[model samples]
Target chain A: MKSAAMSEAAPATTSLPYTDTKPAGHADFYFAINATFRFILRHRGEEALRSCWRDIGGSYYRPVSKQWTEQGMHGVAEYWRAFFKAEPGAEVEVVESADEVRLEVARCPAIHHLRTHGREIVPQFCQHCYFVNEAIASPAGLTARVCGGNGTCTQRFIKRTVEAEAQNLEDIATAS
Target chain B: MIGCYDFCGHYEWTFEWLRQQGGHELVRAYWDEAIHQDSQLHASQLIGEKGIEGMKEYWGPTLADEGAVYERTVTEDVFRIDMHECPSKGFLLRNGLHQYADYCDHCMGWIGPLMQKAGFVIDHEHNHCGQCWWEMRRIDDASPASAPGTLAGTSDVRLRPGWKSPATDHYERATDPDDKT
Candidate 1:
């Protein structure tokens, strides 16, 4: 229900790395993201698909990394809070602490929209979170770990100094 | 990860990425196979089954949802859209994100194939500044696109001041992105 005018009227006090005129994005774009993943997976192997995700995380999201590098975990929490606010149908809570930022996604907008429309989701869809987030965090001296997925999940952005195991692809559920 | 708030930014970046991965053929195939066949399957189904009515039904809510400023004109034989402010292109332009050459072509890249499959042809033009006009007709209609002000009257995008600034890419009954004149 958030309209472009509302976003424009709000004070420029947001943590989003990029700015858009709209308050919430057009939800239909989820279709394109899902389609893009499917296209890459079909044409290229899983590794290449992962590379695409990683490349995008490092390239397209460099501004986010820069912000996180400058502001630390507080920036991470702020970014996620602003990000989900602009994604329609997303229900998420971003909790921040001294050491890390955690995002509890109650309803993932992309997965929800794709499933609602009966679109076939790529099984490795959730893995993009690991690859892309890791790429983004690595540059900011942080790391991301995602556990559950397919609708709900816990994503944590923590300092690189914290001793945590590498992400297990199995931890992320296959989206339907 | 890749949020939809800046989908147009990364979406344009992905075009250059895909082009580097394979070539222009890959980019074209991605538009046809992924976009037209996959992401826009609903659009394809609608237009294929209902034709011009489908275009109206689809674009009505879709454009409104995207917050586009435009007018839609429908005749029995043709459907025309005069875009005064394209939400997608406007977003990219506002954000100053231009990663690919002729980002406007992505529209024709996907919509052209869709119209072709739906047995229609397009007479279109875009100024790359978020202003464009499209006229869709049955392939057999054989009539050329109407002159500016003839179809949509003064609301015609082509008649708008600065509509031809910089340059405009025109397509005559084209159903392919490469058919630009």
Candidate 2:
């Protein structure tokens, strides 16, 4: 993998919950993410692993939840826009409207890096977006739905009042 | 989605999370089985195949990618890393994220096992404040770790101020996280 020089500053408009010196993150960490998922799935049962994801979203990402609660969909849109910008090799577009924020992930940096390195992607990899994002959204009176997977997906974060159908796990494609 | 941007935050959190679920043994297992054997398999493969040269190849680009400010010294007998500013630990420190007892141990936890398999042992130390040093040599090499400035000269991390803290953990020709002195 090519090592890109760290950017001296984060984008001015981005509202990241946490801050770092480097503008973009190191892509090699994607290996740890894939490895962590496989480890949890193998050692803990699927239920426990899912619970872990929820806990991470609800707890580790509490700051994001708070932002969404305060700023609503706009905060969600800004967060993702900045988030994807900092991720190396990500091709994502965050579109915002009156009631929701849509994230169209044309290329997932994590999946791309993992595949490029020939790592075995956990089959349930894409499910994390649903479970984790839902946990982050729920406290903010919002809901998240994800469709498509493998390398690309559309994620919608909308007000719970929108009456969207519950996510069907089948909608998320199994990763390789 | 969990991102590489704040990986240290969540990674440290996961350590504490795993500890809460299954205690320290499970954390050790995760580092060895998941991190050493799975995530860092490339490091293991390289060092296993090429020894010290592999250490150079693996850490060279990897540390640069991580934005670490450090120095490396290579010799026929040993490979040394003087970590003046560890990007991973520094991230957690700067973000005020400390979920694990000693986040620094995670390195020894995984690398120790990998090196053991590669027929090497490590002499290392870390101050909770993101400064550390590592020396890896063949297990049969009984040479003690070099004093400050001996291996890498002035670039040695131990020569820097605040290198030794009250909470520094030291290892001597060891290959296990729990084997610290």
Candidate 3:
């Protein structure tokens, strides 16, 4: 596994031209490169993540999947590897956005990688995403997040407030 | 519910041993890792030919829809491996814990010593109970599919002298999903 600092040295493929179907919000995808990307959120989803990258491109065209480094990326990758045992030479599709991403999918790795490593890789992938939902079911129903370590890495942005009647009471006095 | 070639958590140790045998590249495990011992499959030779590409060939059944696939886990770091097997839905084993547990006390018992000699760490995943039975078909069976063996018989997939089954699950934790979430 590569470290989070490992940049995808392989040149990003420009082969995918922006199609008439813009790669925008919750964009219904018709294809994707099947690596670990083939299985995100696939547990119960009836959605067909067809691995159709062949017609669009080549077999070796992996995106230097971020799993080679980042933990959350690793988590996402592991999740798929366990769930989706892809047949090689098989091409598939996934739902994504204009940036070619989504909330209920592989993007979770990015969001998860950010929220957990907020002190490290956050500033990079933390770009504004309009889909993060603050409201959901009980804590159990909250967006489930887990790491390769089997620990919860879900985003829990609960708000808390502290108050004091006397400001001085809150401050520690100097002995001097 | 995780499993290894022999014992639980021995995956890393197994990998280390295979490495010592001169096949530690990730592709080594990927190649023939899925071959049952009965197959006489050569994992090392396969790696020389296909590497990761060869792994997909020996892996499991293909589901028609993407729905059958879960998000695959690329991360592999076994935090623990359980030594216990459920003899049945709730049956328990009282003193099955072996002193050296790199492998089960049954057929693959030697793996423990082999891995130890190779300087790999081993830990009991702390499973004390077990369920014993047999199966002719595992994945597609709606219930425990009967085999030729009697209740005392063990399948190749089970520890010797007992026959329940290892839950087919991933080693890394990334696979623990929230069915309700």
RMSD in Å for all candidates: 2.1, 2.0, 23.4
Q: For model 3, what is the alpha-carbon lDDT of residue B57? A: 34
For residues B98-180, write the lDDT of model 3, one tens digit per residue: 22222222211222222222222222211223322111111222333222223223332234443333433211111111110
Candidate 2, pairs of clashing residues: none
Candidate 1, A1-176: lDDT as tens digits: 11223344323778886677678888889999999999998998788999999999998888989999999999899889999999999999999998999999999999999999898999888888889999999999999999999989999998897567788889999999
DockQ metric, candidate 3: 0.01
lDDT of 2 by residue, A1-176 (tens): 22337766555556788777788888889999999999989999789889999999999999999999999889999899888878999999999998989999999999999999999999999999999999999999999999999999999998897567999999999998
DockQ order, best first, reads: 2, 1, 3
True contacts kept of each: 0.51, 0.55, 0.00
- Of the candidates numbered 1 and 3, which has the greater TM-score value? 1
Candidate 1 vs 2: which has more DockQ: 2
lDDT of all the models against the reference?
Answer: 0.89, 0.91, 0.21
Worst 10 residues of 1 chain A by lDDT: A1-10
2 or 3, greater by DockQ = 2
Taking all chains together, the TM-score of candidate 2 against the true structure is 0.97
Best by DockQ: 2
**Which candidate do you rate higher for DockQ, 1 or 3?**
1
